[model samples]
Target: MPINSYDYYPLSWYPDSTRIKRPKYEAIITLLEEDIVSGVLKANTKLPSQRELADYLDINFTTVTRAYKLGVEKGLLYTNIGSGTFVSSNAFKSITISTDNSPAASIDLGLVSSFEQCNALLVPAIQKVAGQQTITQFLNYQAPTGTAFQKEIAIRWLSTLGVQTIPERLSIVSGVQNGLAIVLSALFSYGDRIVVDFYTYSNFIELAKLFHLTLIPISADLEGMSAIELEKICQLQEVKGIFLMPSCNNPTGSILSASRKKELISIIKAYQLIVIEDDIHAFLTAPFLADYSPPIYQSLPEQTVYLYGMTKFICSGLRVAYLVFPERFKNTLNRSMFNINVKTSSLDSEIITEVLHSGLAQQLLETKKALSQEANALFNTIFDCQEVTGHHPWPYFRCLPIPKHYSREYIETYFNQLGVNVYHSDRFVVKSDYEKAFIRVALSSSSSLEVLETGLLKIKEGLVGLE
Candidate 1:
């Protein structure tokens, strides 16, 4: 039975309104979950309305709404039309705090990180930096963007990716995410419209939400974001920017072709849209193969903000990333970087500096390519996945069409029970009604051939079971 809205006055139960070390919305969700489980708020109890809670707590109404949405997702709350939100009957039963004895992860094929082999080179590089006579500089403060010497090394690193840019246009960031946040902050404002692929990087989607920017998802083909679709979208809306992974897109591993790049560049010029070319995986795109086409940065340097970083190819422990800002936006980007975090670690900069100059970076890349070749062979044999889109050096992930027998929900449950974690196709989609039938298999997440083979075999068995 639904509780009458007037039956329950706004319970005075609230968390410590003073100490807010975490996000306010998350804090609210935690408090609500705690109260529900402790029986302080019985099941079917009508809670305070979002507006009333916001007014009482003196917090944003949207924050309360977000908390309620998250609570619903976690099965802690339910809502009724023309009524009010109430605690779910099973909320206490569903909410169980995880412990160490929880089922161990069978395999994680979701996140794509640096190859394990990079750790070998990273240790020695750090040791070399520790032994340097100029170690005092690592302890001292540097510019928020980066020092001139760090930028010089970064320029050389960018050249490896075929990006030729001066240091004045470059800003050193802690990682690619930080660089992206700074760039987005500098270029766009709240409520601004930006364009992205229908299936794009999840992190970029989260970043868009953080900035309160609207992401218009455009349908794409195998070659990547469709320029024709983008043109139509630009005609329809006043898009401020376009965020894309041209060389090696995340999850899907799709690359934008040269002709399409030219076509998109034409549209970009016509619309004067700010372009963010996330070339993080460019270096991972076949270490041995020659360049087939120039990057968009080369053709449209003035409009594109090229993001290059070491975290993908090198170990993530060295959180080093460099952004080539358009010369006109230097002041804006520098100011944004300062307000975010003063600067990246000087020690990390020095370590990457040593690796780039000493040729270890190239050696590490070659090792990664070799490992990728071996892993791809295993994946190919298991799934016979010819439709895989990523190129050599493996692009860190492969997006394959989901077998017809299994719903994505079924696959998620099957694998999750086996302690395997996989990213569903819908997770990467920008639109809620997206119907793409695909799942991303992170090729690089498994630490070894044994683990990769085991995970793939398990997926194969699950597919067969569905049949």
Candidate 2:
């Protein structure tokens, strides 16, 4: 019997046990989907514990577990660390960005930041690496982690961002995506619970599901992930780790405040959680934020796996990312990298090393910043309601509120008809419900200032037309 169950009920969700179909787990999942979609189960409605639900339904606990796992994968539900499972924040609907650029009129506000405008600045570095006599060394499969010389460049690059670590602690991977795969495989196990921001990187969500790891989203604000919210989750459940974007968040543009960073460091140490610090936007945002603090990895070096990618900031096509792990994770991470990656394209890392060593990376940063500012300024003049603001000045994307009454399909179709692509907030939501609906519009994807402005105007026109 369920611990505190009454005949009437106290559990957050109670299914009609008699109506359950064959294959109990599938039945449970079906019921959950139906209820969530029908609005019988509200978003973030805390469901019973697996054991309790199993007991209530008079079925096996593993059946409920399997059902819950399937539900999570389907985005119908989510679970807290120690707390019971809950309906997904986006239980009512799921949204996805179409990467297809088939439409010639399509102004892509959906593809966030691969700023190829810096490609002009990268030609010298590329030519230098390709033109070298010893370039053949880079073509081979050796130095998957990175050559000693490449690691030296990584160290110097990290120092500019206030992260100081030895060569042995660093690994050169393909990029953040590849580095993330390595960390998840190396440090975490299947079914482990990890905390993420309420509005998280969508790719991370998919990647976590692939690894069979559960993600618990902590609430965040304009200053970034809330420590109090994290403390609450930690108290309620055992979380294995946290995935953070310290410099600037995707879609929302909320930077992690120094005070919040300190508070988070304390809780993370108290709970002994691993930190996956993705500092992809630091190069762009750090120079802009006057009160910018050092990355969380600086404080919790041993507990953090720092990923610095050259994707958005410098060289996007290079597909090179520098990963710095603590001494403890070195051996395990190396083995995992070797097994999963074999090698991370030494040629790519070499090109990035040249970009850094030649000081072209800094020039790229300055050029990109000027372009970002131009794009943001253009966006500001057209859309007056644009709320996100900081010294960083809208790195690549900004979020705008959508009317609560509009459906995801209706809104997306609205923009699609207007020939612009924007990502809905639901696309990035983790476990919890968002207080309001919004859309993330990218400033960097459009080819020119005029194209970006046209997209912005179309967005504005669409909003007005919808109203």
Please give the RMSD to the true structure for each candidate, in Å. Answer: 7.7, 6.0
Q: Model 1 clash pairs?
A: none
Per-residue alpha-carbon lDDT of candidate 2 for residues 78-121, written as tens digits (9 for 90 to 100)? 77788878887666643434476425567888878666666777
Query: What root-mean-square deviation over C-alphas does model 2 reach?
Result: 6.0
How high is the CA lDDT of each candidate model? 0.74, 0.81
For model 1, how does the per-residue alpha-carbon lDDT over 1-467 read when each residue is reduced to its tens digit? 22324235545455555643458877786677667767788877888888777766777889889778656543457788779888865454321111232335658776666776558767888898899898887786656667788789888778766789998898888888888898888889855678888877877776765665667777778667889999998897678899988777776777787778889999999999998888887776634555446678887888889888788787766888888867898899889988887777888878888888787988888888777777877887788856444343356777666754554557767876766656667567554445566667777767788888888778777657655
TM-scores for candidates 1 onward, in order: 0.77, 0.83
Q: In angstroms, how far off is 341's CA in candidate 2?
A: 1.4
Instruction: Assess candidate 2 and give its TM-score to the true structure.
Output: 0.83
Backbone clashes in model 2, listed as residue pairs: 82-237
| Candidate that scores best on TM-score | 2
lDDT for residue 355 in candidate 1, whole number 0-100: 86
How many clashes (backbone atoms < 3 Å, residues ≥3 apart in a chain or on different chains) does model 1 have? Answer: 0
